[model samples]
Target: MSQTPLQEIELYAFASNSAQFHLTPHEFDVDLGGTVYVSTPIERNELALGAEAAKSALELKLPQTCDLVRHLLANALTGDTTAITLRIARRDPWGDTWWIAGTRWMGRVLGVEVADDGARVRCESAQVSLKRIGLRRLYSRTCSHVLYSAACGASPISASAIVSGSTGRSVDLDGGVPGSVSGGLAGGWLQTPEGARHMIVSETGSGVELLYPATIEPGTEVLLTAGCDHSTATCASRFGNLDNYGGFPAIPSKNPFSTGVF
Candidate 1:
């Protein structure tokens, strides 16, 4: 019997917040020739110590798009390399698989080199240690599901939810009804036409402030969806999404203190 030929290879790029990029095939490539490091000490001849951790690097050719550049720049500015998780997948005639060589390298863009022709951007990234991912809750969340990325099975949000606004760090939305949003939409985001979403820092009567100073073209149309603050009341009353709430609201805030030490 003939073996199934490898048909397709794909690379998945994610932003610092796990927001996936719907990039086309032409935008990137996955190099399978990268090295995987395992720290084994050489003591006796052909004898070695236990493995410490694995290290891998990925090189990507990202197209020069407005949204992609912003996402990369945000990583550069914040020194946040923990959020990126590159999953290389391979597809044979009958099956599809991931983690190309049995590992998922999660890391940030260490350096980005722009082509002189200004047509493409290239980046190099190193894998982050597994310990950090656990401590920061970067991948494995204690919550039930990932926010925004999970399948909520809800109907599509209407285009009417797309609010027009003046471009700036703080956008003033036109016809924004006061109290329309419950508990304010802090930690939410405003999405650009190019699929870039900036987190909302605060919401006022006129507008909302973005967590970063994003590039806003004049007369740019941005979309915003109200977000809950993850409080039990907000999840239950405001969104009726208590079942999906990621916080442990019932957990006691104060530690048990005794009047005297034993």
Candidate 2:
């Protein structure tokens, strides 16, 4: 079939383990390169040889109203590797919808630059080969229960976890499962009624502080999930989901003194 001509582009960012977002950019530029060989004296006028590896980079100038830029900044501050998808779309002559070609890659936010002219935000990122890296835990294991929210196929709570009180930075919750909600769920999420998600930083008694302050009204219905510290016992006992555990619980904690110098 004949393909339609290119018409538009769409960018999406999935950061901090949340849902995807459609990001609008005022200026978007991409650099695509490949590793090639060329010697100065011998092949000065000739093109480089065939490529062995590929490299890609993206730079965007976006409006300050775009929240994805802030999300990218937060990810940068927290050392998160988030995946970004860029779609090249073509207007289908036969229909109203556009046909899209997508390139998905994991990348880090290299920098976030601000301009004095109006409220424009600029950022740079480079492609990451996530598949090339082997599977490993990003953080050390803890004994807390793991959190699997609705986005991860965990069932929704019937009762409202939100209560009618807040300290502008913290929220009090009610109607949580007796043993399910606790301090162990510190890093989990609480999805608000407006579909915005906030991360739980620390929990004490009935109050929970978010990583960043959020504007949530009183009596709003919210959903809460537990957070896991990636321990074997918590996986098996608390969540009963040990089959999916990927950590080495039996690994030695001390180095092997094979030389016997001590």
Candidate 3:
């Protein structure tokens, strides 16, 4: 296969918190024909949010910082690299939870390394504290994209079973193999041998269900892709919010029960 354009650049970051916040990015300049090197100046940011605020407020500041660094790297790098590494250097004296004085969060970029042909791209690590609540959610989104890029050749897994509406039944993949059983997105679920994995669609009740051949152990890395057809339909329907006027009951009176509380 032809090499991707972004197969050489590396990105890393370092962060510090001290009544102030700091973030720095180190770029790796590489000669595709040669080795990569860098000596970029570290970037920094300092801001203050009242100590009494909710942790969520503090958490919100992270994405903008991360985006800034991403944009910087995107502009700095010539093409997409095989892999980029980011390290968030954080120190919370009062713990990852308590945002007291001297509480600090630091971020820094280490650099990037190229992968060999046919080798998977390296996954970036975001070190977060156990006390940090929203970090996991952010990490999931970030890591998912990396995994998708690195595992491009993997096939989708066919679910072992399916549960839709009120009915549950066995499902068979037509000529599908074991590794082909990739997970489905939003409305799609994977069928395991143990039970069915269900994806929630909306508040009302619309989603996909997957029944697997066996119980999926915790921490098992299951690859799931959005079901193209189902996802398209769901999106086209605007998340199941399409108007079904025909199903609406006709009003018996212009003002039912003479009260406007219908």
Candidate 4:
């Protein structure tokens, strides 16, 4: 069948950019990029800059029963929600294939509010984050860098381990599981070759609790990274990279400048 020309479809791409939820304010499913965005009741506010607009915030009202809402609810409480982002893009059929004609809003998923009518997905503009940042880093007790990230240096987490067991939302480590409080795998993460990553919430001798609901097969190979409490002690002792710690732990608790009583 021939598709509508220059459809005003909005696509929400999330889940590490692996999943796409195609939606249109229109009453029919529109095929773009060879994917079908089913028809749904959507209310999106205008995206613009000026005094009278919610410039930095984008809100989408979607049915509570929709797949995207269910997906957000499942991963919202369990995992690091920041990695899950929502991109609002308008697309059109470009002759042979579809193209992202324009992007109205793109940013990290801030939160979701559910009501009897629908679920509201709130997102902050990607630029808003840059505006809040200062020229220099702030003082803190822990390292500011993310684990296994480029700024964390090429520092790698623990070695890969064969899955000894699996559960609906957890995994049995090949060896004893250390809790996050104890500077173990709890605050770290596990990654598969297929690019599936689950952050460890807490760990015990039994297994590691992951943020997502998916389970790993017993024979699947997974990589486990050690967690950091971001304390100076953990930096010196565990990773032995205290020099790279982001926070200024030595900052005095009482600010003499404010007190005028140093």
Candidate 5:
């Protein structure tokens, strides 16, 4: 009896926030037990290894029209790398039979770029996080904790009525019904249900202007987050979470270290 030739195939899988995609450039569709890796125009370059002090990097290239490109752009632009996960696995096929060869690489996405009819994804190994410098205590007045972060513990997000209309960068929220408060969303964010986030540049009459051009449609439910100047007063009056304020409101205007007792 003749033995069937065995072939090895590499598979790529990307997942984030419940959306998962299995892809490969080797075959039309790869089936590993139950999960199928749909073939696509995906390819990756050789992993680059750097010195012990330098971080290793992996770059993946995909067509610009691929759906993965848009997903990558959204995640990268939103700075939500923690939600993105990638894994590369190997499998061997001998005729109709196949077996798993285990995972070859896995890590969080670092960044993405699109150009020349293609998109590139840059990823770093998990160990690279260990190279991060530890945060030192700050005595300055500004808050050290990031807003909405666990350390900050402030939830300013509020769902408003469906959008009434959009003109230029200004979007009419709550059908132009001015909430009881004015300038509630200034210097904050306007987020669409589809996860598109835009910065609120200025609060206009019954609407807020965005920093970017508006594509949001009428009747689209949106979320508005009140902004914070990271001051104790705003923390108390706005979010009503003064207990979690991270800024020092009593810092002396003049630096005592720079100005000695006269």
Candidate 6:
């Protein structure tokens, strides 16, 4: 069977020769070598400038006796390494555009391209493991799940989970064989006889967070299967309720943008 298209992907960029540039997804730019001239959107320019200023400030605050120039150069080299690693992590089953500096992961992929014209990601298989630290707040709010496939190549992964708090919600899984409560008030890891795992949180007003395991290396492709009840009260109110009957709603099988194929 052919693979489904990817819905979302992460990109990383490494500065080669102090290259100055901007990236999609976040739409932020950076000056690779030193400050140069460029034209960019006001918002993007501000964000980029802020990042550069922050880095410069850190460089200045280092030990006074330290060789600041050497330190700065070393840091820039380190940053390039990080960027390349990130870029490599974004590889899918298809061709990828990333520059590997060393064994360390750095670099950023700028855009995403799908195999099919407009298909969205549909997870086929995945390997899940528990994390030492649970999911973080941003992951819960932005990407609650990840979906992958074979045909997509080594350039992209799908949706990252976002945090969404529940409101007086509960559900009985497998027709009441297992019951779960929402509202960020459910805690503990719930395991099924069939071998699926779930980490439950019971703190009031907290959203469930998802963490992408470090084992999910670059160039590996796996599909994601998200439960239908993956919406917060706020999200449901803003975007129509995603629940279909008693089951979690299926994620759209289409990309949100037409340019997703790239």
The residue-level lDDT of candidate 2 at 198 comes to: 62
**Candidate 3 local lDDT, 67-131, one digit each (tens):** 33333232222223322222223333444321112223332232322122111112222332335
Query: How many residue pairs clash in each candidate at the backbone level?
Result: 0, 6, 42, 1, 0, 53
| lDDT, candidates in the order shown | 0.47, 0.49, 0.29, 0.63, 0.66, 0.26
TM-score of 6: 0.17
Task: Using TM-score, rank the candidates from best to worst.
Answer: 4, 5, 2, 1, 3, 6
Model 1: residues >4 Å from true position, as ranges? 1-69, 72-145, 151-168, 177-183, 252-262
lDDT minimum window of 10 residues, candidate 5? 76-85
Error of 3 at 105 (Å): 4.2
Q: After superposition, how far is residue 153 of candidate 1 from its true place, in Å?
A: 6.7
Query: Which segments of model 4 are wrong by more than 4 Å?
Result: 1-9, 13-29, 33-54, 58-104, 108-122, 126-133, 136-139, 174-183, 256-262
Can you write out model 1's per-residue Cα lDDT over 136-212, one digit (the tens) per residue? Answer: 43222233333343432212121223344555566776655245552456755666787665666687676677655
- The best candidate by TM-score is 4
Candidate 6 lDDT over residue span 101-173, tens digit each:
3221222222211222221111110111122256432233322331111211111211222222222222222
Stretches > 4 Å off in candidate 5: 1-30, 37-46, 49-55, 58-93, 96-104, 109-123, 131-146, 157-159, 166-217, 229-237, 240-243, 246-262
Worst ten-residue run, lDDT, model 4?
Answer: 77-86
Q: What lDDT, from 0 to 1, does candidate 5 have?
A: 0.66
In candidate 1, list every pair of residues with a backbone clash: none
TM-score (all chains, Cα) for each model: 0.44, 0.49, 0.18, 0.61, 0.54, 0.17
Model 6 per-residue lDDT at 38: 29
RMSD of each: 13.1, 12.6, 19.2, 7.2, 7.1, 23.0
Error of 4 at 64 (Å): 14
Candidate 6 C-alpha error for residue 223, in Å: 25
